[model samples]
Target: MTLAPQPYLNTRVSAMSERLLTSDQIAALCELSLPDLAERFGLEALLDEQLDRRTKSRAVKQALINTLLDELRVLIRPMNATEAGLVLAWGRKYALFNLKTLLRGQLYELDQSEISANLYELPAHVRLPQQELFRAEGVLELLRKLEQGPYSLIARQGREVFEQKREPFALEAALDQRYYGEMVRRLLQVSNQDGNELKQLLGAVLDRVGLLWLLRFRFSYGLSPSETYYQLVPSVRLLHRDRLLRLVNLETFDEILAALPEPLTSRLAGSTSLMEVQRRLGGHVTDEARRTLANGQSGVARALAYLILREHGVLALFSIVQGQLLGLPRELIEIAVEVSEPNCPADSLADAA
Candidate 1:
């Protein structure tokens, strides 16, 4: 008989969770000066800690992203093959962002140096051949090269958009749909107890993303209902396939919101705009992540939850830091941070319900 893989010893992750800021702590940090904020977070060591506002802001932002990647390295170190693969694939989302940047740079014939300056280096496993991709003669060739890589699913979707001569907006939507679809499939294949817990949190996130994207593409961008349906991530959460299809066909935002299923129907009730729904879902995801980090099994599940929440903390800090650098008022910075790191009152909702 085949032996089972050992569960991860997630002690480091549990300890690391304590390092993330509480919501109150984040709000408190918003009151600090930029220099004080950087020092409080111990971000001085990550970058040059420069004097120029623009340069310092970029360094701080890069430091935040780099910290996430460093933590990700530690988290992915002890997982079994499947679990590691899933986490590593999650990391590739960054690579896709770089891919789009590179594609646009090439398409518009932007200076190579300018494009190169914008690219981030993901770890080797997730890193595509950037130099080779950059050398490709045209957008079609870039897609062709991407098709030969591990991210062929998303690349194929991009290629189809190119072939059809769709707008850049449509191409981006197609690539995102494929990327999230593959992730949902991977999450479904993970059968461990911890996997199930992680899936509940991640599935909720996917639901939010898919619903938000559906609303934007259908109503905001004026895509037809069928076009909107085709653009959505393949979701199996609160907003599953049939639910999303029903949503796309609805004539207006209120109609779709009214038709929304259980928890969402409750959570997003009386929300005036897509932005409100997004903020409400942001809080919902934050609540689920915090609960998971506190109470879930100590393994990849908790580790991933910690990373998710940590990213939120970083975003809140990043926004405050940038706002202060720009000398924005306390009120505007608070507003931005609230939207960035929304937290809701504790409530009972069935996982994967």
Candidate 2:
């Protein structure tokens, strides 16, 4: 798809970037205690109104997510169809989550209202037929109904996995695989500098996801090499097909790590836990995105960078809130959120504030 003139797009992107939450804002949010957070945001009474703490917590979280989606809608509204579609594709992760929720709700025969409450209020153009999906009598019925929408292919594959193994993990993995594959395909069709940069960013993300999934399925889930490989998002630069096959066949996590190419191997060195691996890989992506935002020649890259940073801000907030809900120590919560930042050092949170 042809992008509108770059100069105009770049100016718009710059304005949008300026409007994103500043690092200081994120740090301040991270440092707030539960009471402080509720008081500052005027969320305390609304939270207290909920009968259950879990429900209250979900309400708060959904409020934040809705705010983010609103910002996203504003960003996309002025763009041409192709440009908007490209940007909106990043938000499709939420749609995928909603679809998964529908499948699970159907599987368990959950109440329609209950499922609807859990679903994010996506933009109209990007929304699924949630009412119909919620009303589906069972998993098969859900997939059949989904065939009428944009998610038909994924729904079909998910149904196959469900029917074959009848396992939630396998079905979820199938859905993830389909989503990332389609994401890459869509990004590649753009055929411009911005598209190429965005694809590179996504490629790094997909690689991290593929590696993490491989490790989890192989060790944590005890899935066979073949089963684990089947669930991967077809392979990317960091974990190409040959490398993935080799890593999957290995007998130990260390062996798998040893087989990886340089930089990733060095970057992930000495990581003993999956969480550590995730943080390291996430940091790599964040760093790359920052560089792209700073040096990229295309408006798409700058806009995409803002979106990435915005997402990180949301995640850090969620982590802090979850920690507070669990009654974790403030210091630990700070550490968790600080480590999640992209190119920033652990001490950078303090500096930002």
Query: Best candidate, lDDT-wise?
Result: 1
lDDT (Cα, 0-100) at 215 in candidate 2: 83
Query: How do the residues 165-281 of candidate 1 rate in per-residue lDDT, one tens digit apiece?
Result: 757876777787787777777777778685678688888888889888877777677789988888777555688888888888989878988898778889999876666677788
The C-alpha lDDT values of all candidates are 0.77, 0.73
What are the clashing pairs of model 1?
Answer: none
Maximum-TM-score candidate: 1
Pairing residues by index, what is the TM-score of model 1? Answer: 0.89
Deviating ranges (above 4 Å) for candidate 2: 1-5, 19-28, 34-52, 78-80, 339-353
For residues 1-353, write the lDDT of model 2, one tens digit per residue.
Answer: 24534666567667766645554676667767777877765556334754466776677777677766777776675566666666777777888889988887877778778887788777675688887776677888888888776778778888888889998877888888888787766776776676777767777777788888888888777899998998887544578788888889999878887778877899988766666677778877777777776777766666667677777877677777778887887767766776433333332112100
List the candidates' TM-scores in order.
0.89, 0.86
Give every collision pair in model 2. none
